[model samples]
Target: MSFVRMGIVGIGNMGSAHAKYLIQNEVPEAQLTAVCDTNPEKREWIRSQSGDSVQFFDTPESLFESGSVDAVMIATPHYSHSELAIKAFRRGLHVLVEKPAGVYTKQVREMNEVAAQSGKVFGIMFNQRTNPLYQKLRDLISSGELGDLKRTIWIITNWYRPQSYYNSGGWRATWAGEGGGVLANQDPHQLDLWQWTTNMLPKRLRAFCGFGKYHDIEVEDDVTAYVEYENGATGLFVTSTGEAPGTNRFEISGDRGKVVIEDGKLTFWRLRISERQFNKEYNGGFGQPECWKCDVPVRGVETGHKGITENWVSAILHGTPLLAPGEEGIRGLQLSNAMHLSAWLDNWVEIPLDEELYLEKLNEKIEASTFVKKSQCAKILDVRGTF
Candidate 1:
C-alpha cells in the first residue's frame, strides 16, 4: 500500500531489466522489495547487482506468502504466466503479466476470471501501448476520423534473430519449452498493437506457417495469415524472423482515407470526399476521389517498458485506468492462437477458437519435437533499441 512494494517473479533478461529500472528509481511510486527466481545463480546475480538489500525467494509461492509485496510482476515463461498470475490474485495482490498472456487462451481465460473476482488491479506488459506513435494511431482510428475501415495490412518482418540468439536459451524455439517461435516471443507487441490500434478482431483466418524454416527450431519462423473481420473488412498479416533488412509497415485504408506508418514516419492520405460518396455520385466511369497527402505529426516520446510499469503502479495507487488491462491480453493471444491453429489444421479457423483441438494439436507437437538445443549460455541482450 505504501510506495507499492513490488516483487518480480523472473530474473531473466526482462526481469533483470525491470529490476535495474526499479532499483534506479525509474518507476516512480514503485519499489523493488522482493525478487523470485528458481535459478540460484540468477538470484545471486540480482543480489550482487542490487546491493543485497532486496529479498530473494526461490519460488513464487514463497514470495506471495511472504507479505513483502503489494503487487507482483509475472515475467516468467509463456506457460507460467497464468499460473503465477492466478496465484498472485488469490493472495490479494495486484498482478502485471508479461505479454501473450500465456501459451493458450484456456489458461489466460481462467486467469482473467480469477482476476475479475479478486477485485485487484490486473495489467499486461503491453509496453508498446505507451509509444506515442501507436497511441496517436489508435486515437485516429477510434475517433472515426478515418471513416469506416475497409482493410488493414501489416508486414512486420524486422524481428530478425540469429541462431546464437536462439541457442542462448534451451527454451528459445521449442514447442514444449517456448510454445511457438516468433509469434509467441518476438511479435506479440506488434500483434497486440495491430488489434489495439484498429479496435477490431478478425472473424476467421487462414494461415501458412513455416516450421524450422530458418533455424534448427521446432516452431514457426515464418508466417502469413489472411483474416476476415466481422464488419466484412479483411487483413493480411505477414511476419518472419528469417529475413534481414526486413520491413515494418502497417497500413489501414478506410472510406474517407488511408493511414500508414512505416520507417518511423506516419502518413495520411485524406480524400477530398469519401470514396463511398464519390463512387455513388460520380458520373464518369473511370474517375476516382481526389486525395491529398498529409503528414501526421505524432507528438511525444516513446516511453517503452518503464512507462508501462509506472502506469501500472500509478493505476494501483490512484484508481487510474490501465492502458492495457490483463483481461484484454487474450484478444491478441486469440489472434496468434488462431493463426497457429489454422496453419496446423490447414484450414480457416474461427474466432473464439476450438481450444480443445488447439491444445491437442499443441501437445502432439510437444510430443513429436525432436529438437536438441545446445546448452544455454543465457546472455542478456540490451533490449533498449530492439523494439
Candidate 2:
C-alpha cells in the first residue's frame, strides 16, 4: 500500500484527538478513511469536525467488513483492547492498541497468540517509548554503563484527579468496568518503562493498595509496591491520584553508578570504579568509591502519541520495526495485575502470577461492588502535563 487507510474505533478523547491529528495531515503516511463508535452522536461529531471525507460506522464489525481501512487503531475501553485488536488482525488489517493492553493477562495472551498467527503488524500505543530521555536511559542500562542494577525507586504521584474526573465516566474506576484505577488508567506508561528500561521483570512483588482512599471509586487510588528481581536487586514503586503538587522522580542505582530522572532533567553519578570492585580492593575503613556528577544529555524532543502513530504507519507500509510491539504489552500489564493481586492476597506474589486467583478475586470485587456512581457531564481535560 502506498499509504495506509486507517480506521479508528471508539471516538472518545484519545480516539478523537488521533482522528483530528490524522485529518490535519500530522501523520503524512496515514489517512483517516473510516471511524467507528457505538454512539451515534460521536460519529456525527467526528463527521462534522472532519467533514464528509471520512466514513462512519456504527459497529467495528461493519467497519472491518467494509474494506474501508487497511489498518485499525483501537482506543476503546480497557477490557475491549484485546478483542478489538484480535478482530483487526483476523481481518488482515494491521493493529495498534492503546496501553494496558487489557485488564488481565489472560485475554492479552490470547490476543498476542492470534496476532502471531495472523502475521500482522501489531503495535501498542506506548507513546512514552518515543521520549528521548527514556531512550537514553534504556541505552545506558543495556550497554552496561551502570554495571549491575541494584535498586529502583519511582515516586510518581503527579496524576492528581478530582472527584469530578472519575464521576464523568460510568466505566471509569469500577471493578466491572475499567479494571483498576490509577495503575490501569494513569500509570501504565511508567510501569511499562520500568521493565523496558531495566530489561528485567520482578520475581516477586508485595503491594499495599488503598482502595477508594482518595475518591468514592471502588478501585485503588493509592499504592506502594516493593518488587524483587531475580538478580537480588529490589525496587519501590509509589503512586497515587490524591496527592496534589506531587513528585515524579525515578532513581536507579547500579554497582557502577546511578541515574536519576526528575523535573524533566536527567542526571547521572559516575563512579570511578565499580562498587563491588571497590569493596573488594579497598583497605580504608571509611572511604567509598569516588564519583563524578554528570548530566546525561538526551537528544531529540519528546514525541508522544503522534510519533507512535507515525511509527505504526511506517511499520505497516515499509516493514519498519515497531517501537513497542503488541506482544510486549503483556509485560507491563502483568506488573499491574501482580500489584493488585498482591494487595488482595495481603502477601507477596510471584512472577507469572497466579492468573486464576487474580481473576477469582477480581470477579468477587465486581460482584460485590456497591459503589453508587455519580452523574456528571464528561469533560476531557488537556492531557499535556498529566503525562
Candidate 3:
C-alpha cells in the first residue's frame, strides 16, 4: 500500500480537526476516507466538507466492517478508546488512539494485547512528542548528556480552563463521563513527557488531589503528586486548571548537571564534573559544582496532530517507526490513574498499580456519586487551542 485510507470515529472536536486536515491532503500519503458519529448533525457537517468521496456511518461497528478504510483513528471519550481500538484491530485494521489511552490500565492492557496479536501498526496521538524542545530533552537524557538522574520537577499548570470551557461539553469534567479532569484531559502530554523523557516510571507515588476544587464538576481540577523512581531518583508533578497566571516549568537535576524548559525555551546548566564526584573529592566545606549555563537550540516546530497522523500512516504503509506507539499510551494513563486512586484512598499508591483495586474504587465513585452535569447534550467546541 502506498498510502493509508484513514477512517475517523467520533467526529467531534479533535476528530473533526483530523478530518479537515486529512481532507485537505495535509498528510501526503493519507486521505480521509470514512467517518463515524452518532450525531446526525456532525455527519452532515462532515459530508458537506468531504462530499461523496468519503463514507459516513452512524455506528463504529458499521464503519469498521465497511471496508472503506485500511486504518482507524479512535477519538471518542476516554472510556471507549480501548474498546474501539480493540474492535478495529480485530477487524484487521491499523489503529491510532487518542491520549489517556483509556480511563484505566486493565482495559488498555487488553487492547494492547489484541493489537500485538493482530500484527498491525498501532499508534497514539501524543502529539507533544513531536515538539522539538521535548524531543531534545529526551535525547539528552537518554544519551547520557544529563548523566544519572537525581530529581525531576514539573509545574505545568498553564492548562487553565474556565467554567464555560467545562460547560462547552456535557462530558467535559464529569467523572462518569470523561473520567478525570486536569490529569486525564489536560496534562496527559506532560505526564507522558515526564516519564518518557526520563525513561522511568515511578516506583511509588503519593498524590494529593482536590476534587471539584475550582470547577463545578466531580473530578480533580488541582493536583500535587510526589513520586520516587526505581533508581532512587525522586520527582514532583503539579498541575491544575484552577490557577490564573499559571506556570509551566520542567526541571531535571542529574548527577552531572541540570536542565530546565520554560516559556518556550530550554536551558542547560553543565557541570565540569559529576556532583557526586565533586562532593567526594572536594576539600572545601562549602563548595559547589562548577556549572555553565547554556541556552540549548531546539530545531524544528511541533507538527502537532498532523505529525502524529503522518507518522501513524507511514508506519502502516512503509513500515516506518511510530513516534508514539499505541502500547506506550498506557504509561501516562497509569500515572493519571495512580494519582486519582491515591487521592481516593487518601494514601500512597504503588506503581504496577493494583488495577482491580483501582477499578473497585472507580466503581464506588460512579455508584455513590451525586454530581450532575450542567448540560446533557453533546457539543463540539473548537479544539484548536485547547490542546
Q: Native-vs-model 2 lDDT?
A: 0.89
After superposition, the stretches of candidate 3 with alpha carbons farther than 4 Å from their true spots are 370-387
Deviation (Å) of 324 in candidate 3: 0.2
Instruction: Evaluate residue 304 in candidate 1 and report its C-alpha lDDT on the 0 to 100 scale.
Output: 86
Tens-digit lDDT string for candidate 3 (96-185): 998878888888898889999999999999999999999999999999989999999999888899999988866578766777889989
lDDT of each: 0.88, 0.89, 0.88
Model 3 lDDT vs. the true structure? 0.88
Q: Candidate 2 lDDT, tens digit per residue, 173-279?
A: 98766779999999999999999999999999999999999899999999999999999999999999999999999999999999999999889999999999999
Q: Look at candidate 3 and tell me the lDDT of residue 95.
A: 95
What does the lDDT read for residue 173 in candidate 1?
94
Candidate number of the best lDDT: 2
Model 2 misplaced regions, further than 4 Å: 371-387
Poorly placed runs, candidate 1 (over 4 Å): 371-387
For model 3, where is the 10-residue window of minimal lDDT? 378-387
* lDDT value, candidate 1, whole model: 0.88
Cα lDDT of model 1 by residue, 226-339, tens digit: 999998899999999999989999999999899999988999999999999999899987899999999988999888889888888999999889998999999999999999
| Cα-based TM-score, every candidate | 0.94, 0.95, 0.95
Give me the displacement of residue 171 in model 2, in angstroms.
2.3
